[model samples]
Target: MASSMLAPAVGDIAKEFRASDKAALAGQTSFVCMLGIGPLFLAPMSETFGRRKVFVVNSAMFTLLQIPTALSPNIASFIAFRALSGFFGSVGVANGGGSIFDMFDVHERAPVLGFYLTAPLVAPSIGPLLGSVIVRSLDWRWIFWCMCMLAAFVTTFIYFFLYETNPVAILQARKSELQKKHPDVEYEVEGASDESIPKKIMNASDLTCSPENGTRAVKILTTQPIVLILSSYQALIFASMYSLFATYTDIWSQPPYNFTTIQTGLAFLGPVVGFVTMSTLVILYIDSIYNYVARKNDDDGLPEYRLVFANIGAVLLPISLFMFGWTVEMGLAWPVPLVATVLFGASQVSIFNPVQTYYIDAYAKHAASALAAGAFLRSMIGGVVPLFVGQMCVFPSTSTRRF
Candidate 1:
């Protein structure tokens, strides 16, 4: 939400700070770039220390960082703080799939996973909508202030309510407890350090950040073909989605349309509607498909069974893109192009939910790392694509359609 919430206010911010176009855009790009990068390290760290600890600590940091961002004196400072916030704020993205994997079996996972995945997919569209209202009525910095308040609430909820779900972390804690209770008996946890009780207490790092465990995510990401292919496909979808988001204001606010900031933000509802509608369908039917297919295959489910909806998404994506591009180029009624975004949004959820579920099924134990690998690539491309979108908008229709 914080990543692209300022889209409607970029021009306002540029005017106030006398910043270049690129610098203003960096307000969005810098945050997104770190969102990709942070998961690479944080996801693996979750495997070691535990998901709850990583989530609580990083979420608090992400919330606190928003203060400096809201009060930033210059574009450079704003971008720097926003980037830091993104890094810390990515805990959910880093470990959510792993958490889901810990709790659910394959047949039960699809609906839950589909619902979980909607937060990231739908939040971006909603961010701009709320941001436009805030930007219209309040100062641009208020956007970050709002984010800080929301983050604080979410962080508090997490600390109080969320429990440790990682099986490895749970076993390690149990082993530590058993060792303290029965000094004569050997209590060992696989993947945990064999440090003395005092040493483990004195130096949590040895227990929590083992070198081998820390590097596991990197190894899986680098060595696994399934992870690599799925991550690449996810990256492409993210990049394309963010590219459209980056150019949305430019497309609707100019020339024939002449939309207000609020109206421009409301335009994002097209995608929001699509996301909600398809997410409903996915939540209802995805698990059913998986179970039926598994039954046909002697109750054994391959990760590839998750790809059923992805085919539908792939087909919808190109048609929607072309429809959106040509309709806007022709300067048709706003609804025509908005319908394209609806299809785009539906396609996005259809692909994202299935692919993410496949990642968890394929690497159940290492799901966090697998997701992090995919998120790292997805966010990197999503971040970079936006920087070029402004330039791309300058080209003629013949060239722009290629986007």
Candidate 2:
């Protein structure tokens, strides 16, 4: 949601600070880059500590960071704080798949994960829509304030209702209780003791950020064919999606459309509608498809079966991209481009959900790290792609339409 807010306000930000389109757009790019990077440090902590503990602490930090962002006096401060916000915000993005693996079996994940993963994909679209409204009705700073309010609401809910779902963390807590109750018996459960804060930080950092685990993340990237292909595919899709989100204002707020800020924000509803509609379909049918495919294979479900929707997405995404590009470039009706956005959103969810489910199924034990690697690449692409979008606007021939 924080990621989406600045898209609608970039122009306003440009005007307020007398910055170029490229400079204004950096706010989005920088935040996304940190989104990829911060998780490298934070996610391993979840494995060391507990998912709920990490989530609560980081979510609180994320919520607090928004205050500095909203109160930023200049663009430099805003960008810096925005990056910090994204860094803290990535805890959920990095560790969410791991939480899903902790909670559900493979068969149960199909429908449940489809529903779960939908928020990350949908939030970017919804963010811009809400940003448009907020930017139109209020000052740009309110966007961050609004995000802070939402984050606080979510954090409170998580603190009270969320339990430690990680088995290792749960067992450690149990061991502590049992030991205190029966001091006569020396209970020494291997890998089940609580560590001090400083110790946890050092150990987790050494384990995940040290040369060995650092190399392991890289090794997974280089050696695992599915990781490479799927991560790159997701990266390109996310990059393309972000390019549109970052630039739609340029398209809509001018000549033929002359849209108001609210209208420009509302324009994102097309993609949101498409996303919701298709994800609902996935929630309804993904399990049935998985079950049917498993039965056909003698009741054994292969990760490969998840690719059925991905194949459909591969076909649909390109078609939508082409339609959106040509319609906007050829000066077709505005609605044509919006409908294309819907298709693009639909295809995005289709590909993202299944590919991610496949990854979790394939690497259940290390799903957090595997997903972190994928998100690192995906966010790197998202971060870099928008930097060039402003340049493309200068030379229409070099724009997304060319692709």
Candidate 3:
């Protein structure tokens, strides 16, 4: 919504721009659809090209494409660039969880997953906050330029540090290094030989080829309960969050409290404070609890223990929602509702981290695939929720019906 909020403004820049609505919707659809489809091809390529090269190159390419979107000439150009941005960028997002597993053990995944989970929620919010300030202070073009620069920075960082964590590739590199040191060394480091390519191809074909793809997708859909239940709950939670964003202005803008778009946007600061507070609390406590649980269980490090945090979030969420609902419904002071909104953010992040991490843990080997599917479902809600945000307050159905 942040990326595309100015899309309407972008449409207005040219009176001949007939494609803004369709273009923006198409752009989001393309993003969500491409993410679902990319894995079929990109995952297979991971074997041939190797992980480090794929991520490092694609990350840079994805980042670079934002430049064209920044410089787009019209509606068609805008959608086209946005779609390409999502396409090239999908590679890192699609494969990143797998990289985390390669780099960290189950026990050590807490911090890394926290960072990943934080980035999407926090970055989008932060991106828009900065983007809005820039748009107000400068031009919308700065948003894309800023994105391009950030991407370039990350691309440079990745080139310096990202390496082949694939066991086969690393071992081969080690073998080659040893060979350089010992000219006559005949020691064979067990390795996958190029001669076996055909057999590996056959296995790969059976596993992921088009003929098996449909059944595998269905099988995964049916088997992964975490993918279904947790993702659906996440979608609902997001829908509710956005509904609040939409309806908040209605309550705030009435009776000597009417606010400008900028003020309404700034109203989001309360929710941000809530999210940061909850995120900090959860991140800090989860580690201590993980250690405590590890010691209590004699160091087996079970993932189910994360649910204790999930319960805390569940309680906080409903409590915050009710507080927000009635506070606005009863026409309590504006601070009452705003404080409740902050509480909602706090409750959300508190519950958000551990549940997602638990899902990854339960589906460890297939964590990327699960997270991808869940991410798609969640993104859909984030995209669609705003459409209803505009309608929530005016409906006589329920003054607080939005939540």
Candidate 4:
């Protein structure tokens, strides 16, 4: 949400800070890049320290960083603060799938994951809509202020309600408690063995702060063929999505459309409706499809079964992109383009849910690391692509073809 929240106010921000268009775009880029980068480290850290601790600490810092962001006096400072906040704010993105994997069985994961993914998937579309309204009625800075309030509330909710879900961490904690109660008796977690007292202490420390654990996500990204292919495919989709988002204001605020700021914001409703509707329907049927396929395969559910909906998305994505591009290029009715966006939104959730659930199922114990790997590539591309959208929009037909 923070990544594209200021998008609607880019022109206003550029005027106030005397920034060039590219410089203003950097405000969005900086946040998005850090959002991708943070998971590379934070996801592994969650595996080490536990999800609840990482979530609470990062959420608090993320909340605090919004204050400086809201008060940024220049584009450089604005970009810097947004970058820092994005890094801290990625705790959920980094660890959420892993936590869900820890809690749910494979048969039950799809629907729960569908619901869990709605926030990250849909919130980006919602952000610009809210931002347009805020920029129209209040100062652009108020967008960050509103985000600050929301972040504070989220931070509080997480601190009070979130619990450690990492199985290893829980077992380690239980072992520690047992050791404390019976100092004379040696205790060990599942994979570890009883040893001398000093060696036990060293092993415990290593378990909690291992460098191998910290680099696990990067290792998986580089080594796994499935991770590489899926992440790359998702990256392309994310990049195209961000490109469209960055150009929305430029497209709608101009002569052919001449939409008011609020109307332009309202245009986002098409995608929002698509996102909600598809996600709800998927939540209702994803598990059933998985079960049916598993029964057909002698009660063995492969991760590939999850790709069923992805096939639908693969078909819809290109069709919708072509529709959206040609309709806007032909200067058709605004609703025509909006209807294309609706299909685009539906296609996104269709792809995202299955890909994500496949990751969790394929790498159950290392679900967070698997997800982090995918998020890293997609987010980095998503962030960088928007920086070139203005140039690409100069040749709308060519850009649409390239996409």
Candidate 5:
């Protein structure tokens, strides 16, 4: 959340410096913004380097970048470092499932994915919430300082517990030692070359299940229909979240609410209520359902089993959207829309766990490509839509248009 906020916070500084305009603040308005690309970097690297290493190295880099960005005098320097920080911070998004898989078997993934998805949803809202207090009292520069402090835990955990979970890498290590002990040990592993130690390790790092299964990752990423649908779904949900944020003050500081700068920022607490509630629900109950469904079907679950929950989430979305708009528009009790947002938050997280876990379930071997495919599109959507939200709230056409 802190790294995600640093760019916009810095960009506000940039405007004071007269280095750039509002456009330069592009960070999390959509899926493709600099921070959004963080996941794209995470996806491929998790495949190559293992999830734990990526998390540790990138998280540290992400934190350390904050130091330089703190000192960044120019707008361009800030943007460049901010993007680099965001790109590395993507470890949370890209390697999250692998971390889940590292600890849990298929049976337990439902709740774990739910927990993983919450931070992304919460960060944007929380970033601005706490940040506004800091930026108001302290200065925008503290945002980076705060991140460096928070990052210590994530860095330490990866170094301590996130062991290599890639199956192919584990198998290759056993194969190499077995070959050395029994020189005549026959195996079908490829490369099998008289290569240097670095090259041999690099081959293991390339990390295919077996070498003859040699096909480029590009073909798999482009052809997957499931990835396409899930990515779109993720993008849409994130767009909705970020869009609300982009114009948060504009929407709430009107005649009815007339919130202060601080009060308007605090209005996000309603959505935070949603985020926390939804994440808890997922953690508590999602796996129980996955297990029940899998067992009833003789313990031979297909990845599609996760979609039973997804379909329900899809139905809930437009319903909450309409109800929220209707109540907010009609001057109904504020609790009505607040509760609706809670439902929306829960529903979004509900779908996210199943979709993300199913991506792993379906592509255990090529998980990186499958995850990357979705990350690219989802991040793009999250990044782009926020730019227009400030206009959307005030525009009579969008505001008054009926369902």
Candidate 6:
């Protein structure tokens, strides 16, 4: 939610800091890039140290980092601190699905994941809506200040409520307790002998230095055909959303439909509605579709069955893109572009849920690494594409092509 605020406030940030749109946008882009990149490191760290520990530590850091971003006097400092905040906050993005799988059975995951998946995707759209109001009423710095307060609240909540959900971590703790109770009887960890606390710590350090996990991530990216294709496909979808977020503020504030900051933020309601409606419907029906498909295949479910909704999204996505482009380019009725946003957001819900679930099912043991690779690809594209969106959206014939 906080991350998405910058899209609506980029103009105000640029005006105050005496920076170009692209430079102010760099503050957002750098955060996104680090948000994507941080997961690769933290995902592996969670495997070594445990998810609860890593999550709490990173959440604390995320809250602290937001302070500098809110207090930054210049664009450079804001961008740098924003990037650092993203790096720490991304722990949730990367590990969230893994934690979900740890808690729920496969059959129960569809509806639960539907809710989980929609929150982050819908948040970017929702953030701009509130940001427009905040920016209108206050200086741009207040935007970051609001986010800081929210993050601090969340960090405190997580510290108290969140538990270590990783089965391996839980089992290890149990074994340690049993070992203390019965020191003479040998209790063995699978695949390796039990070591003392200090020795285990050293082994974790050794594993961190090992090249195996790095090689595995690279191999997954390069060698796995499904992972590669889906990662690329999702990257484009994520990039399109970011493009809209980045461009909408500038476009709405200009000529044929000049709008105030608050009004521009209100425009995001269309996408928010679309995302909510689509996600709700999917949660209601996704499991039924899986059940129907499973019965047809002699009571066995396949990961491929999830792709049914994804194909529906495939059809709608391109059509919506065309609708959005034509409506905005021709300066049609205000509702036309807003309706197009609805379509685009609906399409994203259809596509993202299945692709994410399929990855977890297909690579259950290695799901973390697989997801990290996908996150990296999608975020890199999302981060980099916005830099060129302003240039690409311009038409030579249109006067005042400010976006």
Of the candidates shown, which would achieve the greatest lDDT relative to the real structure? 4
Overall local distance difference test of candidate 5: 0.65
* Best candidate, TM-score: 2
lDDT of 1 by residue, 1-403 (tens): 8888998888888988899877888988888988888887787777767889999999999999999998988988988998899999888898899899989987788899989999898999999999999988999999999999999999999999999998878998898799899999997787776657455434432323343544455566678887778778878888888888888888887755768888899999998888999999999998778878889989677998988988888899899999998888877778999999999999999998998898889887878878887888788888888787777676344334333
Per-prediction TM-score? 0.92, 0.93, 0.76, 0.92, 0.81, 0.92
Candidate 2 residue runs with Cα over 4 Å from true position: 190-197, 207-218, 394-403
Per-residue lDDT for 1-403 in model 5, tens only?
Answer: 7533533353467575675434445534322365455654465555554566667888888778879877777766766776677677766766776666666777777676777778877776677777777776778778778877788777877788767776654555677788899998675444234457565445544546443221223335456666776788888987787666666555565645566656755666776787787678667877777767889999677888877777767887888878877776765555677777767776776677678778878887556556655666666677677766655564233334323
lDDT of 2 at 100: 88
Please, what are the lDDT tens digits per residue for candidate 2 over residues 1-403? Answer: 7787789888788788788767878888888988887767666777778799989998999999989988877788888988888888999887898898999998788788888888888888889888888887898889989999999999999999989878888888888799899988776656554568787677666644353233345456668998998989999999998998888888887655678888888898888887898899888888788778889889688887877788778988999999987788766668999999999999998999888888888887567777777888899898889888766764143233332
Go through the candidates in order and give each one's C-alpha lDDT.
Answer: 0.84, 0.82, 0.62, 0.85, 0.65, 0.80
Residue 265 error, candidate 4, Å: 0.9
Off by over 4 Å in 4: 191-211, 395-403
lDDT of 4 by residue, 114-193 (tens): 99998887899999999998999998999999999999999999989998898877887888899899999986676434
| TM-score-best of 2 and 4 | 2
Backbone clash tally (model 2)? 0
Minimum summed lDDT over a 10-residue window in model 6 is located at 206-215
List where candidate 1 sits over 4 angstroms from the true fold. 195-211, 395-403
- For model 3, residues 1-403, the per-residue Cα lDDT tens digits are 2333342233233444565443444544454445445544444344443578768877788788878877777767866776667656667645676667667887788777766666545543444346446666777667678778888888898899888775655776677799899979864645444436565445433454242231233245456785677767777776677556445545565643456546655666777787777777776778778778888889667777776677776877888899977766666666877788787877777667787777667766555555555555655665566664554455333344334
